[model samples]
Target: MPEHLRALIVIVILATAVFSLAGKTATQLIPARDFKRRRNLWFALTLLAFLTHSFWLYAAAATFCLLLTRRQEHTPLALFFLLLFVMPPATVQIPGFGLINYLIKLDHPRLLALVILLPAFFTLRRQPGVIRFGRLWPDRLLLAYLLLVALLYLRETTLTDSLRQSLYLLIDVLLPYYVASRGLRQLQDFRDALLAFTLAAMVLALIGLFEYARHWLLYRALLGALDIEWGLMGYLGRGGSLRAVATAGQAIVLGYILAVAIGFYLFLQGVTTSRLQRWLGGLLLAAGLFVPLSRGPWIGAAIMLATFIASGRHALKRLFLLTMAGLLSLPLLMIIPGGQKLLDLLPFIGSVEKENITYRERLIDNSLIVIERNPWLGSVDYRKTPEMQSMIQGQGIVDVVNTYLGVALEVGLVGLMLFTAFFVTILQGIRQALRRLPRHQNEARNLGRALLATLCGVLVIIFTVSSISIIPVVYWSVAGIAVAYVQWVRLQTQPHATLDR
Candidate 1:
């Protein structure tokens, strides 16, 4: 068999095993009526991608997926998450004519969003009673951020190039946020959408574990099967262990997705029927997280747990016990065989990848110096600066690992403030909504807490890694979900309010 064919077989087997083991449990959280339809659609799309020989055919498959889900309640959002989480970021640029020589790169998420999400979002907005996008502060802030960055793009590139880049932002960033914020309105919508994401992540988790065990990237040949020349697929290692990238293109991205899934599972476990099943699901996600060996996400997961604990009842005692348990594990780990090697993989305390830490520190220092040069609108050629140029790695690429610094360097302090405020506003809304919930409304309150913790954790971890692959997609979608939750909470608290669209 061809290499790509073998790789596909491995992925199919791993995904089948994962679904067989935990799929029913994950799908149980969503409505039974919707599950069969979505599952069929998901499999059909996957089959099309698997059998198709060209990128355009895969794009058509994605477009069909979106259109079929258009009229269904929250299925469009579900399909979007399913494709976004399950597929890798394989790209093939559509060649443009004349003055616009370079068109948009239609990656998996971008193809789904551009081909359908934008049109669908506009169609939904035209309806009588649907929730509007910019009515909320987070929505307004996100618009401001996107517009600011788009306008700033004109400083460096041609009008055509800038417009193309702006469109990329619209499809890649805004559509995900818009569909999520507006598509999901009811409690069940939230459950369905989140469950779709979690199930996809569970598949990714299983794939990551398989990759770690085999010391092979099972999905690398996927690009070849599709005949795309994407550069994100490669091998990475830490302390003699191959980091698992799965379909996430990068290990850190995979770890980040698993971390977010684990956070969602925190809320999911509460709604699940079987106690042992949910625990098993959580363990699977945790094990997936470990395979990536991405310390930043590991720290972020810790922060998420702490925040989740603090948000609920018995906050003080649970946190204390959790902290004590962590402290106690240090000595226990030290005495265990090969514990020292494991300890070295941790952040701050870890000796392995110490240079990465130093590089990040220098990135912060250098980025600030470069930002100081053009504090208002930022220099478009910031990457060409001596400070940034010096930080270039052996790969001949200046990897802007820090998302915040990347924002600051690209669009200056103003854009950074807008970007920062967008999340901060969303976080504030989540917190405010959570406070409005009555004590008996534990389920609603818990969902809000999970969103709060997850967003907070994502915010911190992005400081360590750049906004690449599914990282931005995950956070943008979560923020939109947060906005929807806030709206849902307000509707619940109001007199004679109905959540029906």
Candidate 2:
């Protein structure tokens, strides 16, 4: 925690206590007005503190929400979940500070992971199966996954390191997919989950944006003293006036969520939304993604928007307006340098170490090499090729940024095939949903389709970065809720074959 934030928390507590004691029942008797006043005071303090500790404040806010809320308070809780989902990925490395290390440890993503894995564990009661798979997706594929993991463990010529990794992957990585799949098999769960997440995402995004623009008395007076600015520049390859990440670790995250949000906004309200709202929401999402300056996300957002306009048949006037805007801005982008968010990506485009391209190229090269090694059964610890004399002379584990390769590295060819099977099943499910949606109910499946598209984009981008960087916990938690909600609604109205659909 920042120094001023610590002080602010203390002050808020003191004021709350003092006011309550003066009323009647010690700390519990504070007048409602006084309670709100103190809360507002702390809200301001908290917002300022947020600049320095975006991830922490966001996470705590979500946690506070979880602690205070019951499952019944669906609306508020749903909103809070979205903000939690939006919490930026934390690096949390504290050099020369041992105590702080434990306080904000990133070594283990405990709370986030626990929320998913524990529930799944208890739900399964220790069985190594997708508890809901018998009802939702085919059971054979999941069983195949188990067999694949087992195979990875049993290989004779396998590197010891690969065997250890296969074990971890079977649990740590596989567990999440299992939990999400189970939760989302129900439609109401999916609806409530998405509802909570969407509100939270908007609140977090707006709050972060507000603080950045104003730099109010709370900011100039307090956070300024702490040398913290509420912005997303740090998440960029460069910092200090780069652009707004808005409580996200990377531009891709912001884009992914915004794209999802736009999809939801359109689908939920559909043609009922006012023209003005449609325009404004479009602008908000566009500007939101523009600030993060991530090319992959930009591409994703563009593809989604284009797909939406083309496949879903959005208003032609709006599309024309957007096109005109893009054309008009081209000159400014060329002349003013801030015009091209993707082209001006800090370290990649603007800096001397333009190694981003070459690095990606090298990743592809490394992946090909691994495939060539043991083309069918898979190579052991191909990711950790540093120990092998053939791969690299003195490098660490092969820095293959692609997540597919990462999965392949730990689980081997069999695991990869099982993963491929899982993906195909999901794709089929989504395709079935889209096909079943009525002409009058385009909106019914659009959001689900949009989410699937976003996931596809994310999967593609994860080839460049680790997808589960402690950032994905809250994200997937909420995503599971959405899938559950959608599936539940559909199932309720139908044949019940798919979760009674």
Candidate 3:
């Protein structure tokens, strides 16, 4: 057989395997009783797909499972959480194109989430009176922001590029928010989503530990073989020690996700009936936060941990126990092999801080200059701006690392205000819920407090990095969930009163 023909045959086989895996996973998502007759066939297909070692196949299978289960009460929320949590950090580029020729990645998962959300939209359309639009200031603000983005699209030099970005904003940010607010109807659904997130975080934490210790990324090489480069997969620090990216594209994002998980688990520890599960989950998430060696997220996590300690019952006792545990473990930690290395992994633990501080300062200085030129309506594509291009050529500054600055650069001061207002409304809503709930409702209050702290941490972390990834979608989804929870609380508190529409 010709070599070209053999290669084509191999590609066909791989594609078939991937589709089979997706079908099987979808079948598995159906209840056992519903799909009992097809179980053996799906099992065999899943086994075959696993043996093929195709990362894309596995990712598709996971997505299909979520899609198939969307009708279940808890599944939509679970699907949104998993889509953000389980993204593979790989990038694919068009052959013979320049550096900026990279294809859109990670957007597919968002697309999948949007697809799962379609039925929810249809259900709402069928029930006209059920789709209440009152007291949704956050949703209004989000819609305003999307409109601002559309207006900016008109000013873009490349219409196609701007359209694509607008689509991403719709699917990744707006759609997730819509799904969370509508699909997660109760506090129990939110808890189930958080549980799923925590479990996924635990697994990522273990993978990060392995990567840190061995200096080998888990799936990077496999991605590389398929011509998909993992962005910032590994970083060298502390004289060549590896900084773990985990499944997040970069260390800072991973740290941010872990910090949020830690905050949630801390709240869970206070309210959950199972003590062992809470403690174990919290410890695993804490370790996960430490492994990333990213300072911004460490600061965020510290703020969140402080909030947790300050609000919990018997705070002083818990603080004393935590302090004593650290003191008691110090000597033992020092004696163990690679213990110092582990300590070094924590932000500010060793001599690996000065470089990052200097780099961020330079980035901020450059971004401020760019923002000054386009203050009201930002440069739709900063790279295309002559001044920015000149600056890059003159000074080696290529990208804005700050999320706020990146937003200001892409949209404008107006966009920034709209974005900021969206979060402000969410925080205000949660606060209102907290105030209205009775003091005896510990679980509800705990959840509200936890979400507030999580948002606080997210706000802090975003200042240090351009969070133009699936992470922002997760953040917005949680905000939507908070808004939904607050709305539910309001309805329960005022059973007879009609909410203003």
Q: Which prediction has the highest TM-score against the true structure?
A: 1
TM-score list, all predictions: 0.96, 0.63, 0.78
Question: If ranked by TM-score, best first, what sequence of candidates would result?
Answer: 1, 3, 2
Worst 10 residues of 3 by lDDT: 33-42
lDDT of 1 by residue, 331-404 (tens): 88899998888899988988998999999999999999999989978887888999999999999999999999
Please identify model 3 stretches exceeding 4 Å from their true place. 1-68, 87-108, 124-135, 225-230, 234-239, 311-350, 381-397, 499-501
Better candidate number, 1 or 2, judged by TM-score:
1
Q: Judge candidate 3 at residue 249 and give its lDDT.
A: 67
List model 2 lDDT by residue over 67-138, tens digit each. Answer: 443232322223233324323434443233543322223322343444435444455544432344445453
- lDDT winner between 2 and 3, please give it: 3
CA displacement after TM-score superposition, residue 268 of candidate 1 (Å) = 0.3
Better of 2 and 3 by TM-score: 3
Off by over 4 Å in 1: 65-73, 496-501
Residue 369 of model 3, lDDT score: 80
| Residue 191 C-alpha lDDT in model 3 | 66
